[model samples]
Target: MARVAGKVALITGGASGLGLATAKLMAAEGARIVITDIQKNKGPGAAKEIGGDTLFLEHDVTSEERWQQVVVETEKKFGKLNIVVNSAGIGTEGTIEDTSLADFRKMMAINVEGTFLGCKYGIEAMKKHSEPSSIVNISSVAGLVSGFQMCAYSASKGAVRLLSKSVALHCARAGYNIRCNSVHPAFISTPMVEAPLAAASDPEKARKRLLRMVPIGKIGEPNDIGYMILYLASEESKFVTGAEMVVDGGCTAM
Candidate 1:
């Protein structure tokens, strides 16, 4: 049997990168998927590729109204929501001194506030499910450690990490049968990072520099994180909650 058979999952930022990868994997595992993203072209295309009970909704993660609409539409189509993957995020490249208030706020609104809204509404929506559910927030290795020119990004993801734990604890204490956890990945190969890498003075050299930081000597594929997300979203992780799973190619091990 498929691991997530008969489940329904909502993944924000599912138009591309890790989010799209996870949506494909979950759908293959028998979960009905709803992919939310602002990118209209790719979002619908992804849903079509899944070719089953899947949907793509135009969404801005920081908007509370959009989140509520997603929840409503998810339930309307799937009858219940069993999993949520908060993969929508943006990154800024600047040290504290180089960072502007506008840049910092933009990162925070999309990364931090986006994650916050996902968790809040995810919990509310999951509660309606008659079965156990899971919430997986996509954080980053930067959230776990300090790095160059990633102050705002790290701070934003750090908030997601702690917020997941806090919400997990709250649900546990309340006896809500819902689990919440965060996944921290380091330099997963995705379009999100590709743009910044290409914009660097020497793109190839910059790519090499980033790869050197990973002890594993390679960048991660989208499916690497997708599979981890599947495990967390599946019934197999029934005992796990309020935890952070690091998928950083041993970057944090050093």
Candidate 2:
């Protein structure tokens, strides 16, 4: 059987990059997919690319009302909620001394509050299912390590990591038959990393500088994280919960 056969997954930030990659992969592996993103232009295209039993919705993960509606719409359409990938997040480069409260709050709203809402409503919907369900939150190596230059981004991801664990423990203790985990990745060669490099005065120099942080001698691909998310979303990872799966290329190891 396909790894996620008969499963239903709702992936946030599914318009591009890691979230899109995860949606495509999971759908290919025989899951019904509902992809949501604030990027209206790309979300439908992402869902269409999968071309089978897939849907796209415009969503703002920071909105609690939208989260509730999304869960409702997904269940109404698919009949059950089996997997959730909380991949919506924003990044900012600043230090504690200079980072504005506005910037910090924006990061927190999307990264922290967004994942919190996903877990909250996703649980409410998923617990009704008889099969095991999974919630995968995309965190970052910055959460495990201190990235002083990315103050708001790092703090937001750190909150996601711990919040995932807390949700996992809560569901497990309550006998909800659900799994929750966080994924931490760094320099995954997506738009998230490329946009900043392309904006730099010397993109090549910026790329090289970023590569030096990884001892693996290569940057990562979107599917690198996508595959990890696939495992967490499938029953293959049934034994896994409250886990922090790191996909960085030995960056945090150093």
Candidate 3:
């Protein structure tokens, strides 16, 4: 049988990058997928590429009302909610001193608050299902370690990491059959990273510099993280909750 057969998955930021890859992987494993992202133009295309089992919704993760709408629409369409992958996030480049309050708040709104809302609404939605469910929040290596020029981004991700654990423990204590976890990846090759790299004075040099941070000597592909997401979204990770899984090519090992 397919790994996630009969599961219904909702993935935020599913229009591109890791979320897009995860959506494809989940759908292939026989799960019905509901992908939401603010990139409305690309969303329909991604849904079409994923074929019949997938649906796309225009979503902005920072909005609570929008999250509620996504939850209601997903349940209405799929009849049950089994998995939620909160892969919607953004990264900013700045040190604490250089970062502005506006910039920091933007990061928090999208990355931290976005994740918290996903977990809040996801747990509520999944409870309506007859079976247990899982929630996967996409964090980053920044959440686990400190680095130069990454204050706001790191702070936001750190909040996501701990929030995931908090929610996981809450679910466990409440005797709810829902599991929550976070995935922390480093330098996965995606448009999100590419844009910044291309803007550098020495783009190739910048890419190489970023690569050197990973002990594995290579950047990760979207699918690399996607596959990890699939495992957590599946029954295979039933015992795994309140844990942080790193997909950073051993970057944090050093």
> Per-residue lDDT for 19 in model 2?
93
Per-residue lDDT tens digits for candidate 1, residues 164-184, read 999999999989989999999
lDDT of 3 by residue, 122-229 (tens): 999877755879999999999999888999999999999999999999999988889999999998889988899999999999999988898999988999999999
For each of the candidates, give the backbone clash count: 0, 0, 0
Off by over 4 Å in 3: none
**What tens-digit string does per-residue lDDT give for candidate 2 at 1-254?**
99999999999999989999999899889999999999999887888997796999999999999999999999999999999999988887999999999999999999999999999999999888778899999999988988669899999999999999999999999999899999999999788998999999999999899999999978999999999999999999999999999999999888
Say which prediction, candidate 1 or candidate 2, comes out ahead on lDDT: 2
Clashes counted in candidate 1 amount to: 0
What lDDT, from 0 to 1, does candidate 3 have? 0.93
What residue pairs clash in candidate 3, if any at all? none
- The lowest-lDDT stretch of 10 consecutive residues in candidate 2 is 44-53
Which candidate leads in lDDT?
A: 2
Quote each prediction's TM-score: 0.97, 0.99, 0.98
